[model samples]
Target: MKTKLLLLSAISALMFVSSCSSDDDTITPSIPELEALELSNCSSGIAEGETLILENRNNGVDYIINCTYPVNGDLIIDPGVTIQFGTDATIRVYNSGSIQALGTAQNKVVFTGEDKVPGSWKGLYIISSDVKNKIEYATIEYAGAVGDDGAILLWSDTHLKMNNTNITNSQTYGLHANTNNNELILENNTITACKAPMYLDASYVSAISNGSYTGNNTDAIIVDRGFIDEDHTWTKLNVPYHFPNGVDVVAGGNLTVMPGVIMKFGQDSRLFINEGASGPKPSIIAVGTAAEPIVFTSIDNVMSAWRGIYFDSPNALNEIGFATIENASNPDQEGAIETWYGTVLNVHDVTFKDIQNCAIHQYKFPADPDTLTRSNLTYINVANAFCQN
Candidate 1:
């Protein structure tokens, strides 16, 4: 019995020792607290297959992205997140990376600079990202240090959908589309306080609905390349089209202005139609009715605020019916309507008023008088009715 009791006690002791050793071998790793980390020691670039989630800490420290790095993974920023950037530090999204920053109206995700000044940091750059990147109910301000591409640069086949966002106080352009394949969708956004609010080719803009472009130094939309390939009609709903830099209808392009379309031009702005080379000749068919005529005027209502339209193709078809042109024809520039290279123009039921120069100026007159067709043309407050060069 004594040996039995001693053996039992030895077995119990061995079991207890083995249990303690097993517990020691299986240890729980310590997780460092985010509050304990110094801001200087924060990581700069986000690596592949890694996700960076920014939570709302009550602390006043602003998370800073130190350098320009391509985001290969995901960046999920929570609401009320304020991210300050280092000098020229841009968040570049490339190689199928995505950013899902869905903030509320009250708690918006802000992308600003460390100094909180205009043009302080480079803006968000989305390049060649096939994923669905979205930024909603956020505030992007004080950017535009990257280049002439504006504060929010969308480049190289990126699909960025922005809604209910406020982009203001940019140095050059508020939203600049550099590439032709950018599928940008803007809804209920307010873009203001920049040299130009939106700079894009008219072809790449997907949608512009319920947006306001006010307080801009230049025009509302600065179309870099105004080449309309197919037949385009500007209706009354898209009225008040402000063109600060003017538009050029390239060769093999056709633009048709419908009735009740108002075109407002800026200072020294003029519309040019290029001569065709091989394909069908470019044409501008601005047809308006007597009740609802197409109106072309200046933005500030200043006389001669813009130079008028110029046609350069002789073989191109040009027609202006029931149109009213006001505040055009500067004395130093050409007339309200000038045709070059023996291009013929037909003006019917058209009225040209407040003209600083001639209402119609034809350079190198055509062989036939019927080439410059006119019917019921009215000139009010005009300097010169017709001038031949």
Candidate 2:
């Protein structure tokens, strides 16, 4: 009887040990101390002329901060706060200090308009401050201006770094820059449907332009008289599109359209240069390459599409080469490109095909030097109806 009792006690002890081991394997240790340090309800609404810091709590609860404030100083917004926009709402980072918005790729913070349209409200405006800012993986849409550039209005010395941000469908211009030596480092951003995607101007005609403005836009990238000292160089920024129906530039100011740049047209969409508008007359010096010629076609059924490209300069001496100008018209005088407004043109090897008006048109200018010079349309072949007026 004693041996049987001892055996039963040994078996019970073994069973208890097995139960303890199983429990240890299944249970997870708690991290209460680390979890206690998370923020909670960090400022629901911000007041006007106030500076604040915002962060999302560690408990996976995002803050829906819907307030438009006029900042007195700097507003430091950390990662994780998903800032939603209300009706006609806007946040102005005033001229007092600056705004530090640092967001990551995977878990980024957003500040967008109420309706996710192209020109919703006025976007984040930074005025007269030494800014060191960062905006990554953010979507700024439906934020537009009426008269000026719509989406973003920037002024003074503001250093901004943007990555993978999107600005779409504002009223006038997508992003406006009217400052001196402000560096705008943009990478992999999309700007669409804005009047002018990127607008650059300067106070007192700037000396050294130190801003890096390069992104994909649906409209023309307009630059005002900011190019004073620095090599006023502009590049054609293109986005990936399946059926490329792209933007056109009708100059509103005195401008220079560079060569070796790609000016692609949408399905049946062409560029128009009218006779003597208000702001400024642009000089397009487009010289495309032989193998990779500058293409102009319609955005829809491209086979038999139609558009127009009119270069109405009183005095234009245009240089041509490896370039294709489709859907253009001839001037009202005898064929031998002449103009009243004297235009400086230098043309080389180029092609004019399938145009609505003239393959090569130069009419008499009303200006002083009313003749075209240094132009080479030698190897150009034009199909369809092209006028040489």
After superposition, candidate 2 runs with Cα above 4 Å error: 1-51, 58-65, 113-121, 129-133, 141-149, 155-160, 168-183, 192-230, 239-285, 295-319, 329-345, 354-389
Tens-place lDDT digits, model 1, residues 189-281: 878887777877655433556667777786456555456655555555332566677777766777887787777777888777766666666
Q: Give the TM-score of candidate 1.
A: 0.68
**The candidate that achieves the highest lDDT relative to the unseen native structure:** 1
Model 1, stretches more than 4 Å misplaced? 1-62, 73-81, 104-107, 129-131, 146-149, 156-158, 178-181, 202-207, 230-245, 256-269, 285-306, 312-323, 330-334, 339-350, 362-378, 386-389
* Least accurate 10 contiguous residues by lDDT in model 1: 33-42
Alpha-carbon local distance difference test for all models: 0.74, 0.50
Best by TM-score: 1
RMSD of each: 10.7, 9.1
Model 1: colliding residue pairs = none
